[model samples]
Target: MFRRHKPSSSEHKRDPAIHAPALPHNDMRSFFSLSQLVLSAGHLKPPPVLRHSKTTYFEVEILDAHSKKQICVVDKIPPSSTLLDVKHKFHKVCPQWSPSRIGLRLERNGSYLRDSVNIKALAASSIITLYFTDMGQQVTWTTVFLTEYTGPLLIYLLFYLRLSSIYDAKESARSLRHPVVHLACFCHCLHYARHLLETLFVHKISEGHTPLKNMIKGCTFYWGFTSWLAYYINHPQYTPPSFGNKQVTISALVFLLCEAGNHFINVALVHQNQSGNKGSFPSPSINPFTWLFLFVSCPNYTYEIGSWMSFTVMTQTLPVGVFALLMAIQMAQWARKKHQLYLKKCTTYRWRKRAMIPFIL
Candidate 1:
C-alpha cells in the first residue's frame, strides 16, 4: 500500500474551507475570544437584580362600645402614628363623626385612650382593636366656664341695678338702697369677675370637651341660683348683717383673705404645671398660701369654701347659706376625687393629708 502524505502547516494556512466550512463575514464571534464575548455581554447588557424591601405597617380596628360590633378599619398606618392620627383617619371615613365627639378605648367599658398615646405601644401585634363611643354634641370647657360665670355676673348686676322690669316701682322709688346691699353687689361682682378673668387668662384647661346637655344643666343651675340669691341680697327691704358692722367687718376681712389665698394657690398650680412638674406631689413653696398643701391635698378648694362661708356670714341670709352649703358639698366631692388621684399617682403624697378640710375631714 502507498503511504499517505501528511499536509504541511503552510498548506493548511493557505487553503480555505479545506478542513472546515467557511464562516459568515459579518459574524461577531470571528473577532472575539470566548472570554471577551462573555465580558462584553456582562458590561453592555447586565442581568436584572430582584430586590424586596420590608416595612412595618399597622391596622386599627374600631368597634362599637355598646354592641361590640366592628365599625371601621384604619389600615396601613405607620408604627410611628399616634391615637390622634388614628382619630383623624377615623374621622375621614365617618364624615358624620367629629374628632371631639369620638371617644376610643381599649376595652368596651374601659377608660378612653389619650390622644398622645403612640399606636406602636398600644398594638399587641400587627392589628390592634379599639372601642368607639359616640360622645353626643360637644362644647369646649372654656365655653362652659365662660357661660357659667358670665350668666351669674350679668344676672346679679341686673338685680343690683334695680331695673324697672325686675323690681317694684313703688319700692324702688320710696326706700333708699342700704349700704350693705351695695357692698354685697360689689362682692358678688368681684367674685364672678375674678372667675371670668381666671377662666380666660389663668387656667391651663385641657382640650377636652363636655356634653352640650351638661353645659345646659350647669347654666341652668348657676343662673337660677344667681337670680334667687340676687333677688334677696339687692332687695330694698333687705336687712344688714345681724351683728351690724362688727360682724360684717370680720366676715369681710376673712373673705378678702381667702380670696387672696385662692388666687395665689391657683398661680402656684399654673406655675408648677408650666414647669413640667404636673401630676407630681406639689410641696409648699416660698408663698405662704401654698403652705396649706402640707395639711390638705386640695388647698384651692379649701380657700374656695372659706370664701363662700365668709360671704354667707357677711350677708346673714338663708339663700347665701344654702348656696354655700351646696357649693361646699360639691367642692368636697371634687376634692376627694382629686385627693384619691394624688394618692394613686404620687408615692410621696402624705396619707395624713385631708381632701379639703384639715385635721377633721
Candidate 2:
C-alpha cells in the first residue's frame, strides 16, 4: 500500500493554499528551475510542416449566429506559425492586448479556433471559451493541450535537434563515445529538455506566466519515474559500481509497482474530476509513490535521490552525481517546510510524522 504524506490537522487549519487540487508531478521539476514556467509538452517544438501523412492538413471553418458576426479572423498564417501567431491574431481583433497578455480561444477539439480544429469530429457540447469574465475582462486562451493537437511542429523541432547533433558527431564522439554511454546521455538531455519545455509552457499558457519559487512547492514523488532511470545507472553498462543484477531487477520492479499503483489510483481520480469534482487540472503525472507519501511525506524526492545515488555508483558520472546531491538539498528544504507546516496546522498531527522519512528523522 502506498502512503500519502499526511500533514497534521494543525497544518491544514493554518494554510488555505494547502488545499490545492492535485498538482502536476512531472520529474522535470527537479531538473531546471526554468521548467516551472513552461508547462506544456509542445511549446518548445518548431513550426509544423504538415507532412503528407494519413492526417490531413489543418483547416478552419466559420459559423455565425444570424446577428452574431464571427469576430475571429486570421490575417496571415505561416505554415510554421506558432502560439505567438494565435496571440497576434487576437491583438488585431482587439488592439488592447500586448503580445504577452494576448491568447487565442480553442474550439474544444483542443486546437486554436481558426487553425486545424476537427470541429465536425468534436462533441456538440464542447464550447471553447476564449475569455473568462470571472477571471478578467481581457480575452486570453486556454492552456490545456496546445501541443497535443498540433503536429509537424514537434516533427520540425525533433529533426532539428537530431540533425544538429549529427553535424557535430565527429567532435561529440571524440568526447562522449558511442552506444550505451551516448544513449544514456541522450536520454538525460531529452528528459531535462522535456521538463523545461513542459514547465515553461504551462506557466505561459495556464498559470499567468508567473515564476515559481521552485518546482517541488508541496508535492510528493508517489510516482517512481526516477527509480527506473536509476536502474539503468545501476546496471553494469552504466554504473559498474552498483552493478548487481538484484539491485537492478529489484529497483526496476519497485518502479513498475509504483507505475501500476499510479494508474489504478488515476482511474478513480480521473473519473472523479470528469464528473466535475475538481478545480484545476488532474496532476501531470501522479505515480504510486504518492499514496506512499501520505504516510512517508516526500517519497518521490527520497526515491529520486536514492536513484541518482545508485546511478552515480553505477555510471561513475561525478557531474550527474553532484546534480543529484543538489536535488536532495532542494528536497530537504521542501521537507523542512512541510514539517513546520504540520506542527502549525495539524493539532492531531503527530510530531513524529517526519516529512521525508518516518521515525528516524
lDDT of 1 by residue, 220-324 (tens): 989998999899988878888879988888988888888888888888888889989777977889888889999998899999999989989998888888989
Judged by TM-score, which candidate is best? 1
> All predictions: root-mean-square deviation over Cα?
8.3, 35.4
| Error of model 1, residue 128, in angstroms | 1.7
Q: Candidate 2, which ten residues in sequence have the lowest lDDT sum?
A: 210-219
lDDT (Cα, tens digit) per residue for candidate 2, span 172-285 = 334432243443443344434443454354223442331121112211121133333433342333333344555544544444453344334335444545568343222323
Q: What TM-scores do the predictions have?
A: 0.82, 0.35
